[model samples]
Target: MTTIDPGAELKARIAEIKERFAIESAGGKLTVRRDDGLYRHLEVEMPKSSAYWFEVMTWPGALAITGHTGSHIFRRDEDMLLFFRTCMGPGPDWKIDTRYWAEKVQPDGIGSTGVQSYAEDRVKAYIKQAAQEAEADHPGLLAEVEEELFSRYSKADLETEAGAKAALAAFEFDGFRFDTAGWEFTEYDYWFLYTCQALAWTVAQYDARVQVAA
Candidate 1:
């Protein structure tokens, strides 16, 4: 079998996502939605300034105008699971930073990095447990899911040094930062914008598959 470069695959996927979903401002708000009956409709919303920053930020001054207000609605268990698996990870410790929502939901609540990490870790644990139960109940379904994931993102390539470096560079160029605690998603960051695109692409693929199966 021909080995695929994980970094190359990831770069290609990101490019494809960017092309597939052209982020446009919907007045003062930007919303991307995909409704597939087999999966929950994926709905993501952010401020127009935030979208502009992601799509057309040329200088640091542009950052001053963007707000980090955003919302993600995953209405079904399968949609959430797919998100965790594809965007976050299928690994036991993988997590999605919820700091933006956390701050909005409880501004006076514990707002330290440690607190956010702990909260995300707890959520990861629950996702992992649920995934395990799902795998047990579905027999070969887990393998199928893994296969599908691999087709899109090859693990072997990502493990290679070059691939790892490329992935890091891509994230950093998009303004992601890592500290002792973990990766941080800055306000109006490129990573979040890319994630919105990725989720939309994934939902479209799922919708296509559902149509074919039906």
Candidate 2:
């Protein structure tokens, strides 16, 4: 596989999206290496369709996630929530300062809380609606299927090498589509994540999201 420059990819994507989607406020930002990681930050405008996919895949629990192009603020205590921040930006212009915190709900629920709690009713409703549509459209449910298969194992087991092997053995999203509600568990979550990265890489090859100053 060839290497990619995330900054260029982000800008090109934004312009391309603006042209094709025809949404004025709909835009994106890219940030590279703010928190020290190999992957580039991508904060897309989160179109209705993509937002549905993001929620189904990430599955944030008991916290609120609010975001826009330059900012994506997620409130969750789970360890993965921290990683969510990095995932917010596309390449080099995303921010995580206090100004982005528009509201906080339900007080911190646990120790040294890392995420914000907002009402889940809206997102839940959207997710439910989206699931019905996906079922009809047959868009492929990799994340849900994978998470369910892996959920059976204890947290400790998931951390061990044996657990990883056992997990992958359970299911592979590419081969099938899982028809389930609420994502009980699956072995395909990690596989789905990596596969998504690979998909993004593939897209970048054909359509580099390059930034062009206005």
Summed over model 2, clashes come to 36
Off by over 4 Å in 2: 1-40, 48-187, 190-207, 211-214
* Residues 14-122, model 1: lDDT tens digits: 4664653455323222232433333233333434343432211112111101123232222223334343345444433333433332222212234332212122322
Q: What tens-digit string does per-residue lDDT give for candidate 2 at 78-154?
A: 43334434444464333322222322223344532232222123222333444445544544553463245334542
Candidate 1, residue 159: Cα displacement in angstroms equals 30
Candidate number with greatest TM-score = 1
Candidates' C-alpha lDDT? 0.34, 0.33
* Per-residue lDDT value at 153 in model 2: 44
Error of 1 at 36 (Å): 14
Candidate 1 collision pairs: none
